[model samples]
Target chain A: MGEFELIRRFFDRGDRAADGVVKGIGDDCAVLAPTPGWQWLVSTDMLVEGRHFLSTVDPERLGHKALAVNLSDLAACGARPRAFFLALALPRADAKFLEGFARGLFALADAHGIALAGGDTTAGPLNVCITVMGEAPQGQVLLRSGARAGDELWVSGTLGDARLALEVFRGTHSLPGDQFVQVRRAMELPQPRLALGQALRGIASSAIDVSDGLGGDLGHVLKASGVGAEVYFNALPRSAILAGQDLMLQQQCLLAGGDDYELVFTAAPEHHEAVKDAGARTGTRVTRVGRIRTEPGLDVLDSDGAPMAVLLASFDHFKS
Target chain B: MGEFELIRRFFDRGDRAADGVVKGIGDDCAVLAPTPGWQWLVSTDMLVEGRHFLSTVDPERLGHKALAVNLSDLAACGARPRAFFLALALPRADAKFLEGFARGLFALADAHGIALAGGDTTAGPLNVCITVMGEAPQGQVLLRSGARAGDELWVSGTLGDARLALEVFRGTHSLPGDQFVQVRRAMELPQPRLALGQALRGIASSAIDVSDGLGGDLGHVLKASGVGAEVYFNALPRSAILAGQDLMLQQQCLLAGGDDYELVFTAAPEHHEAVKDAGARTGTRVTRVGRIRTEPGLDVLDSDGAPMAVLLASFDHFKS
Candidate 1:
């Protein structure tokens, strides 16, 4: 089939009324009629083979992670996803690959009620680039620069499992087959905390997605808000698989290893109850692991309340 | 420099107030406040190293064309450029390359008043994907499904020069030094018909950008509008460089050779004067090339009005 025909058969969802998308695929440009008082939130993420994902990953799971990562950006901004565009470059028109990719893509899109608005498909090496558009009330959009001193730092869902899966995949560490199931799933099919993020709109003074580990991602909020933070190492939330590992490995994955799609946010101490309520309503586990401070550096405090410094760097594509 | 630091130092424009952009760059998601009553237009295009462009291309021109092609889609829909997101997967962080790329990117961005929003930068094979957003008045956006049976087909600017340059690059044909210069420019730095497209908004019945050849692109308008076309070979406007070529070569280049970022639209006979006036106001060269028909297929007519048959075909990445 032709590329255009391939697009219609695989990517076009046909109905977009549920999401307020006036036009979808097959047009020169997609038209969106956004909520009048809401501001538009837009973010783009590109995933490359070998760099972002292993070549052995299932096409279905790869598709899910590609869109899910972009959705996480919207979640960090406390925006409701309205639609997305997928620009894919594939080596060839492999039917099995296309079918699996499409299934995984629409599954997540359906859950969020996000329409596939428009995109381009071409022949090249495997690459997936997604641009997601969302909406939030004009003045109520959560921002990274909203944090202040004395605010409680919080993270939703578990951390470190995705990194554990990566280390195992890279042969740097080994986990029992049964123990790796959940970790592998964490690395492959992460769920964007859309509900909890939206609920934290008024509660979160600052927010960011933990894609590059909690400490590094939270660093963005601190730098933008002109504040510092104190992360209690013992307070970090980790899965059974991660917690069972050695403390050193746990610290490495929790603080610096990337691919965590959880949300890390800050709220005033007075809003602690509301933050927990938001997480509860969404059925997402939320934990208070740190505190925003007026000081200028990030301090990782030991369980005994003493500063313990070690190398924990964020994933920087250029530098690393 | 790290990816984040490189982004701040090079890509971030610092001031986005002029475009009504509430937030940009450093944020997880960029916030946009579009014109209140207008509908938003969005289009995405991906360029791979050896597919859409050659590796030997100048970084500056490649940067401009990457964004320009997407702008061309917005132009086809008669939308005014507002902003765009860049998702780049670079092979490495080369300071010289980044400097030239950013300079070219910002140059076109500044001219069109389009702000750079949030994007992802990663290390991988050379690939550039751009998603551009624009705005058009409600009920006035040009669509491919609006053409009537009896309408004049019009194209803005000249055609076939880009294809000639490609042929030269492939060693299939050669041009004089001066001729090659202009043809190479056409292939490298195409000027999106922003002003002309907006001018034709009310005058044209249907429109599309000629990226995949005029015949193929107009076929989209035909299929969408349920009409046919009669392209007059003698009537197609050509650049001075193209006109000096052999007749058979000229026919092939003008019909099926792609990469021409020109606008093609159809208008009723009664609106001819208005179309001319619009072109004059925008300082764009426009020509009438054919007429829409009630028949079932595109008919290419020879110089003397006889049915012309040739091996002209549109560029399909998969089939090619």
Candidate 2:
């Protein structure tokens, strides 16, 4: 099949009306009619081999992860995803790879009511860049700069499942067949909490997506909002995959390993109930892992309320 | 310098007032204010190493040409250039390369009042993909499907200089330093006719940018508009660099060699005066090249009015 036909057949299955995308894939350009009283939010991220992902990962999962990360960004901003454009660079024109990738991408896109709008395909080393467009009501878009000193910090879903899954894939951990599958799925296909984000729009004071682990991502929110956070180590969400891991190793992995793609946000003390209620409506778990403080740096506390000693700093793209 | 500092010091020199761009580069995500009376025009193209470009071309020129080609797409649709986002895949963190590239990109962005909105950078083989956004009044976008049988065809600027420059670079032809410089510059920075595109909104029946050579691009218009064209060889614009080239080679290059980002359009005969006036205002020369015909394929005639046969087809990204 030709390139155009392949795209249409695999990536064009979704309810366009639900997404507010007047036009979807298969045109020189996609046309969008804006939602009334809403502002569009746009962000793009690219993943390259040896930088963002390993070559051994399933192609289908790679596709899902690429779009999921972008959606996570929209989730952080409390935007309802509308559509996306994908620019893919491949080493060769492999029909199988394209098929699986498009299938994976469209699965998530359809679930979230996002249409694949437009994209470019070219010959190059394997890379994927996804640009997601979303919408939020006027002045209701949450940012990373509204957190206050007394605000409570929260996270959707578990923190270190993806990192633990990575360890399993790296051969450092072993599990039974079913357990292995579950952990691997978590690493491969993370579900971005889009509905929860939209619900948290007015309630959350500041927000960011956990792409580069909790420590690094929260640092971005703190830096933007000009406040510090005190995370309770005992309150962190962990999976059964790390049940018997060494304490220091588990803590380090939870703090430093990246690729979680969950929403990390803050809410005022008075709005905590509302925030929790919002998550309940979306059927996603929300954990109160930390609190915003007047101090200007991150602090991790043990169960007894003593500050944990600092070790490694947050992940730096350039340095990493 | 850090990523944030590098961005501020380099890619932030363009005008931020371009239509539809409420917020530009340096933000978490760009905020675009959609035009009330316009339909947004968007297109993306990717250029990869050992494929779209050679290793020896100046880094600055690569940056300029990347954005210029997308601008050409806007020109084809009679849309005014607005804002663009870039996705770059680099092999390493080379500060010097980034500096040169950002400098060249901002140079054109500032001149055309286009804002650098947002982009992603990743580690990989050198690849650059630019997504450009433009705007045209509602229902006024000059698509490739509006040509009529009696419309006159026109072209902006000369063609084949960039192809000739490529030939020179490959050491297949030797020219004087001045001619070489001119041709090389043409290859590096073919200007997009933004003013002509805006002016052609109401006048041109159909239009397309001549990036895949005049033959292929014009063929697209013909296919889309379900019409034919008749070319007058004597009216074709030729640069001084082609003054003494072999007649057959010169004609072949002009028709089939790609990378000429000039506007090729068809308009009603009565709009001739307006076209000339638009050219004068924009300080870019425009000339009549051919006419739309009732036949279903292209026909080329020599200066003496006899049929001329095409010896070579135009460039194709996947095939060539």
Candidate 3:
């Protein structure tokens, strides 16, 4: 089996043609007829070897994380995924790796009801770039610039687990074998909060997925919405791995370490009930982590509500 | 400038927000509201260094060809270009190369009125992949399976120019400096037939863009349409580059040498007048190259009406 055969066997089994898709994987292009009254949302992300993932990372998990990250973008926009196109660059033709990768990719795609529409396979260093298209009602799509002063900020799921998982990978932390499996899995196979996002369509004022760490990604929402935020450090959801860490150190990791893939959104206080209803529907906990403020920059407050100063900020691909 | 700065300076110049685009560049995602009565067409292609193009090819042209090839897929479906997302993998950060590439990409994008929505950039071997989105009226998309028996086959623009240019690049052919510039330009920078495709929406029974050599790509259309074709050799458009080549050799080049982004389509005999009108409206010449037959295999005939045997075959990345 080659890459093409592997893709056909593992990833192309779904009947995408019946999903309002005029054309599917077997053509030069895929033709999609939009369901009436819905707008399309498109997002793309590229993951490169040695930069985005470790060379020895599990191929299945790599595939899952790749699609998961892009799905997170859709979640941020309050769009339900429809289909996706993948472009994979491999160093050489490896049937085993591709088979495993496709298996992992399709697992998530099927769960989200997104069909693998079209893609290109070529010879190069391993890079998986996925472009996802989703849909939502017109004028209902959430954006980063919709937040306003006095809005409440919330996050879905836990933060800093993926970052801690990386530390476990580097041997800086000694974790029990089963705990290691769970944490590493979280790092590799993140579940984008798709249901929560769809339910938040008119409820959340603004949103972004936390891929570049909470501090950096939330900073983007703040910058776009032209607002500041006051995050309560004690309210941050952290794994037990960070339970006993120094308060400031744990706060830094929660703020700066990335790969969470959780939805960070803001909503007017009047919609708090709707936010709670969305969380119940998705079976995920939504916590009030902060509030959108009129101030001009991020302010992190401790349990006692005193501002804490910090340095060694979050990851910036261009800054380093 | 770094990658982010370079992108902001060049690719972020156009404001597509006013063009019915809900979101443009520099966002977590782009939201597109589908124009009522139109379905979306999406396709993606990846070009890797040493696999797709030589390292010495002009960066500007490489960028143009990458987007144009994807646009050709949209043309094949008889859709109007709407928006595109690019994923670029580069070895190292080079501002000059990016500027030239963005300039070339935007030049064609502006001509077609397509918006640059969102994409990802990463560090790796040079790989350019573009996912293009287009739209056509509901149920009006021309698929490869729509051709019928006795349909007249047509191709837009000239053939074999890109193949001839590749020959020049390989140093196997020598030409006057002026012709060299023109041929080389054609090989590097292909103009996708977006306007012609939009006009051919209802006229062409079946269509495909000639990217994987005319013979191989046409074979796909035939397989899907469940028909064969009898192509006239002398009817094919030839350039000065093929002036002295043997008739059989030139025919093979036109048949199996790929990288020509022209549209090869079939129309019912009753729609011949309308097809011609489409060509005239788009300012592109359309030639009647062949006729679809009930028989299910390809046949090429010379002007003398004798079958022509050709040796050139389809280009496959894995096979190579």
Candidate 4:
């Protein structure tokens, strides 16, 4: 099939009319009408086969993960998902592959009310690059630079499960069949905490998505905000499987393991209750794992409050 | 180097701030403030190594072509370039390649006054995907569906040079060193008709970019506008090199050669003088090559006004 035909059959969602879109697909450009009182938030992510995903991954989950990762960026900014542009490169227009991919992608997109505004398709090695556009009310958008010293550091949902799943895939660790399926799902199909992110807009002082491990991703917020952090290492929430692992393994996965698409945020101590309420309302589990500091370095504290000298490096695409 | 360091050294443009950009790089998502009286126009394009370009292409020229092709889509919509997000996947972090690529990319970006608001970079096969956001005054954006019967078809700049250059590279044709360089430049460094496109905003009834050959691209406008066209085949503007080629080669290049990056538009015959003024004001050479028709098929006519039997197919990414 031709490029246009491939797009029409798989990616086009013209039947589902979306609000704020002046013009959608089949045009040179997708035109959108921005809400009057909101600011546009844009983020992009590129996924390559055998680099970002395993060659054995199901096309459906791959599609979901591709868009989910971009949405995670929007979620970090406490922005509501609006629209996205997809640029896809495929070895060929395999009908079954496209069908499964679209099914997974649109399922998540429809859940978030994000429309497929426009895209380009071509023949090449498989690659999916998505640019997601979202919007946040003026002055309410969460930014990493907004954190202040003494703010309480918090995280949504559990951490390190995705990393545990990756370890299993690499044969560094093994799990029972049932548990393997569960953690593998965490690695393959991450949920972008949109509702929780939006809920934390006014409450959270700063926020970031935990895609590159808690320690490394939190370092970004510290650098941008010009503050340090004191993370209670033992306070980090993890799955039962990870908790059963050895202390060192648990520490490594909890601190430096990546691909956990959860929000790492900060809020003032006085608004602790408000933060908890926001999380409760959004149906997301909130855990206070650290606190911002005026000092210029991170300090991970053990359960007994002693500083731990953990040296697990975060996942770096090139260095890894 | 790590991904963050790579971005900081090469792609980050935090120094040169552009209007409407609330946040540029070093963030989860770039925030943009949309103009109140304008609408957002977004387009995306992906160029993969060995598919859209040769393996031996200059990094600088490839970068320029990457952004230029995306901007061409914005130009087709008569939108003013504003901000762009780039997602690049490279085989490795080659500093020299990045420096040259950034030089060409930033030069064009500076010329168009478009800002590099955000992007993602990863280690993988070479792929450059850019999503450009532009803006057009309310109700003034040109669209392919706006063409009507009796509207005069027009085009900006020359056609077929890029295709001729491709033919020479493919060993199907040959040119002198000096002339080859000229056509090669056309193929590699296409200039987007931004000025002419914006100038034709109110005057042109419909517009489209000639990326996938004149015949194929025009077919899109015809399909969208529910109108056909009678193209004056002899009147198609061409470079001296292309004009020197045989009639059959000329027909193939002019009709089905892609990657021209010129604007093909239609204006009411009553606004013919206004259209000419738009081109002159923008310093773009405009050619009156055809007229829109109520008939539902494109008809290419010879100098004697007789229909020609041209059967060249447009460039398709998959089929080609």
lDDT of each residue in B170-203, candidate 1, tens digit only = 9999988988999999999998999988998889
Rank order (by DockQ, best first): 4, 1, 3, 2
Clashing pairs in 3: none
Residue B74: error of model 4 in Å? 0.6
lDDT of each: 0.90, 0.80, 0.84, 0.92
Task: List the pairs of residues colliding in candidate 2.
Answer: none
Q: Pick the DockQ winner.
A: 4
Tens digit of lDDT per residue, candidate 3, span A82-150? 989988888777878877888789899889888888788877768898999999888899999999999
Residues B101-127, candidate 4, lDDT per residue (tens digit)? 998899999999999999988888899
* Ordered list by lDDT, greatest first: 4, 1, 3, 2
DockQ of each: 0.85, 0.49, 0.65, 0.90
Candidate 1 residues A82-151, lDDT tens each? 9899999989988899999998888998899899999999999899999999999988889999999999
Point out the worst 10-residue segment of candidate 3 chain B by lDDT: B11-20
The sequence of per-residue lDDT tens digits that candidate 3 reaches over residues B108-154 is 88888888988887777778889999888988998888889999999
TM-score of 4: 0.99
lDDT of 2 by residue, A289-318 (tens): 999999999999999989998553555555
